[model samples]
Target: MAVEEVFYKLYNNILIETNLQNTNYDAVVLIAYPEDLNVQLPRHIGSFLEKAAKVDKHITKAVTVWNCDYVSGGRLVISPTGKVTPYHDVSVVKQAAQKGVLRALEAGAKSPLVVVQSVVHFPDAQLVAVLGVLEALYTPLQMRERVAPKNFTKIGFHAEETLDEKFERIVRNAIALERARIITRDIGGSDPERMAPGKIVEYINNSFSGENNITVKVVDDENVIAEQYPLLAAVNRAATRVDRHKARVVEIEYKPSDLSRVIETLILVGKGVTYDTGGADIKIQGKMAGMARDKCGAAAVAGFLKACSILKPPHLKVIGVLCLCRNSVGSDSYVADELLVSSSGKTVRVTNTDAEGRLAMADALFKMSETAGKELNPHIYTIATLTGHARACYGNYVAAMDNHSARATNHSNKLQLSGSRVSEGVEVSVVRHEDLAINEGKCKGDDLVQYDTGAKARNHQLAAGFLIKVGGLEEKNLKYTHLDIAGAAGEAPSEPSAVPVLSLCHLHKVFM
Candidate 1:
């Protein structure tokens, strides 16, 4: 049931296929310079093959390389229709790669694996290539009502272009696996039973083996309520009525032997709402269709840690918490004006059950913050698909973040640049002390309001402020930030996580 093969890396005796007919390749891919396709007709008809490749450009169709024939070998040529730019950015390569796959399929090539034979390439060429392959794999076939084309999953990359070092291959494969899982889980459909919070815990558990050196923790429903996570318990009681799956908070930890960065511990928090019925405050029918993706923030965190297990940066111990649950309907469901106490000892007055994502994380945030500086140096960051206002503001190009610490503020800027370098973009904004005050005073009895009374324009900022209060991170101790991925998740292929995975790697390697 695991999704593989679509991201395969060919190695050793299969390094580079000089011939397609003698090998088992259904289709091949090659990047060629504009002039290479404009060569004069060879006495052996090399002249005609180059002409056919060029004329297709004038028509703006896919670049048809005559590599499919046994005499020429099955190489699908990749050249920009109007421009011949190198595959430097991940987003650019992703789009081009998806187009290449479609064209190869049109040309009767199934299970196409893009092959790069260039002697010179980008440093992260393999990374860019896999991003494209994932774009194809992650695109659900019209509501996922259909399976892989004819139930045949064939598209992948043969990374002969990568370094021969084993570590490099491991890192590349790690990213591939993590991203594939992230995208699949993020855009997965609204099957309450299939994608329930309980199911996600198992899906994430399977991602790491004993070799990864990561320990996963799942806080059960009984324990959550017992431990005074009334807010999280309330959301769970409402969504999971009679399912028996129950609600759980999942935690992941990785401590590496090699130490280099100044950052000792990085804590990641994510929202894992399996489905959003909006609870008593239900979403309209059209809006409800894609609510299954509500857990994207949590998925990204899980994916980021999976990559961390592979990289195992020096001096870095990573802990990730997935706030798992749903916002559904029932007589037990929480409604407006309900009083709930957070694990931090703060009270929350529920004004909108739809705003349950942040409420779900309240206790976990407090627990993680308390655990942060207990061992190694501490840095806390929260990633969640919490608000739609952010998406309304930025679409999918930028991740809107509320960073803490002058160091974290600088790191957020650096993360944006890192994301840009890899084609994953991010944006940062500050949550003022005044805004935190507003949330803390929004209601009479409770210490916090699930929904702020201020303008809707500030929901994203208020949500950050709420999480900050829950984690006792208001003092901005260590390093803290809230990444509201609502604006950055979905709406495009392989987007929502554009910033999380690469940003984590960059923070650990370049900025820390």
Candidate 2:
């Protein structure tokens, strides 16, 4: 059975308790008494009327309200067929009034009207509950789509009151975000030819536009590409034979209604390698099987942009940077040990072809920081399915985070303060400037004893440290955090864990 079907079955009682009974009405509304009220007559009467309307089909309106000795008031309407429809209770009086007006307009002269006598004061909890119910009722009806015979809807709530309210909105939006992600992945996997890179961009734009007001920009700069992203070009050499593997940088921006109030800006970057064949330094058979899923980080960032656009927190501007390309082997592909210069003019020695994700991100990080320095002065973060060492460190539950100051030199101190110990079997260590530079071949402590060797057994920690160097970010004004999500990007047997989506949302909330 499908996930929603199973969910419905599990929550049968709760569904029924919400007054969602079997009926021929295309839509139904459940009304409850205000919590601060002291009377029970209105609820009792409404239940009886609801049962009678189910059999007669003439009663179109039903109203349940709280009645107390201190206060009393209620509203109800019924159609010519005796089908009863409930209207505003003490809670959500405005929304209930608006819905009632609409229902009356639809019913015309055949509407049945009933007012329940009650004595109850309006309560804050009732207003919140009623608003929640109304939001749930309108979303499905408003956002309905005819995609694949399934029910797809957009749900929104006014969550500006409290943290719990905001959290509820996040959870609801996250579900929709995950569903969209699954649909995108399934479509890409099933119809590889149809879901090309351009099509993927179109899909993202359309999907996100349906629920948000964000604009997507596709950036193409040959100068920037050659200067900062040579590794991306090298990795796509094979695909260039079929068609020049066009490198794309997707930028999504969320601007506020009043620009003057904007305080802080955040730029989120993702490495988007649609496919990875490991180039000349080929992966083992089993390891190469799931290379198609390498673009999951891009999907997560896309989802985050969609969510942030909809949530629209105050005074925060967010940008999503997606560096998209493919890694394939060909005559022109770079070989192992080839030293490639980044856009920042930093040399990266390609010891392993599988490390292509970081190469794509290196350019994205450099461009984002450069652009930030000029235009936005934003904090930068790059997420990618980059290193297995991250999986080894944090497992699938949490992503490994490397938080450093904007300047490269501050990385040494940040690493130390963050409890990052030197990896075993790696000669190149991230040394403090005050201690000694690795090029000088000098160390304050035992450096040679910690170095290790071999392909699979090589030092992944050193690999991570190297990527930071290539990005050339200053630690003082720039705060860079790299999320290596190699293990969290794919589906698991237990659940569809879109881990990075939630993490990105949380990060945006906290820092932005």
Candidate 3:
């Protein structure tokens, strides 16, 4: 017999032994009483019987015997054929309930199963909070497809209590993150000429309009992002439709309610290269594949912003910056050995087309620092899937964090002030331009192999150095950090990871 049939048989037997009057054997109900109950049955055996009953609709009455007294309780389905699945633990129970329904549908079960786990002795407040979070999570996971498209644009709270509010916030954040992934995957590799950043900004603005206080700003002035930032423009020039396309910076800001508690503003910068083809210095074979995931860093930042909007820390402001464009092969693409000037007016000699993430980030970081200077000059954090060196160093489990020296010192001091032990050996890496090298093939007809020896060996640090150059922040004016998240952003064949998002959320909680 099948698993469901076996469950039904066991459930029916338990119901007959327990003196339950139901003969149909379509469902079973089991009661969990305190240890002092005057029952001769083994606890584990009784629990197992209850679980079996939930597998098939075989029994339907649950009577609790506490101490020497018997109390009549509400009925809980042990076996929900189609609508629900019974669970002992609320967390697992919620997951099981949904999964059981799906499984029944797949198995072509005729009846609707509804699994219910009723808490008999637990505190009402805690139970309610737990149930509320589960309900919020359930709505998005089960009904995302059923919800109208217009509902995606508005923001609403799932639960009302402040103590349990974060749970609902996190659920919404996770949903938005999933939605962003879907949007990005769907729009991937579309004609860059036809799809503009303004369109994306409009979509986001429209979809998330009323619910959360989110402001999406699209910087369309190609020169605003391009003219001085040659390194960024260099890769973009390779696109066949560069003239028809405008490089854009998309900024999403979320501000908190109170000004006094706002300890610091957090700025998240993401490398938004929608598509990357190793330009004139083209990637050969294996290297060019999966370039579509180049924008994962930007996706993470967008995800972080969505999370912030939902979480809404009382005194934290989050600014998400996405530098979006496509790097394709075209006549305007900067060839090997081209010198490009950054927004900070620092000239960078382009050595490789694939090192385009840093180029886009250079201008974005500069603009962010400039903008912050006019405001509160908040602590800034830039995250990007910028280098293979970071992957080699951290292996996708953790992002390489590079903090300004002063900020590191200050953080250590704060730890000490709080009576916490601060490790002396901990250090943050900073990349410098001197670390970068360009191999322009061979000069003239010289057969001797020319090596760019002076170029920086620490690839990750050099990338950070370039951003600092453009950010124009003095050592004293700002606390800045760069997170190289190449390995953390994508899943490997062996395992899946959401390192960047998890790390950002953790950091947000700390600073908020």
Q: How many residue pairs clash in each candidate?
A: 11, 39, 29
Q: Write the per-residue lDDT of candidate 3 for residues 368-420, one digit (tens) a residue.
A: 87777756647777777787877776565333444454355454233222211
Alpha-carbon shift of residue 119 in model 3 (angstroms): 19
Model 2 lDDT, full chain set: 0.48
Model 2 CA lDDT for position 10: 13
Model 3 ranges off by over 4 Å: 1-199, 228-230, 240-245, 406-457, 473-476, 491-499, 510-512
lDDT ranking, best first? 1, 3, 2
Best by lDDT: 1
Candidate 1, residues 1-512, lDDT tens digits: the string is 33323333445212333333334556655433334334222132345445665656442334554543532235544534233355444454445555666666666765555643222323344455555555554534233435543522454444343344643453355345444444345424335566677777766666565635689988775664547567788887765555544677788887776545435678888887888889898888578876777877777777777666655656677888887787878888889888887778888888888899888888888888788758576778888888887776667655455546634548667777677545566776667876577677454777888877555577777778778776688884667877877766664334344346665676566222
| Residue 165, candidate 3: alpha-carbon lDDT | 43
Identify the superior model by TM-score, candidate 2 or candidate 3. 3
lDDT of 2 at 224: 62
Q: RMSD of candidate 2 to the true fold?
A: 14.0
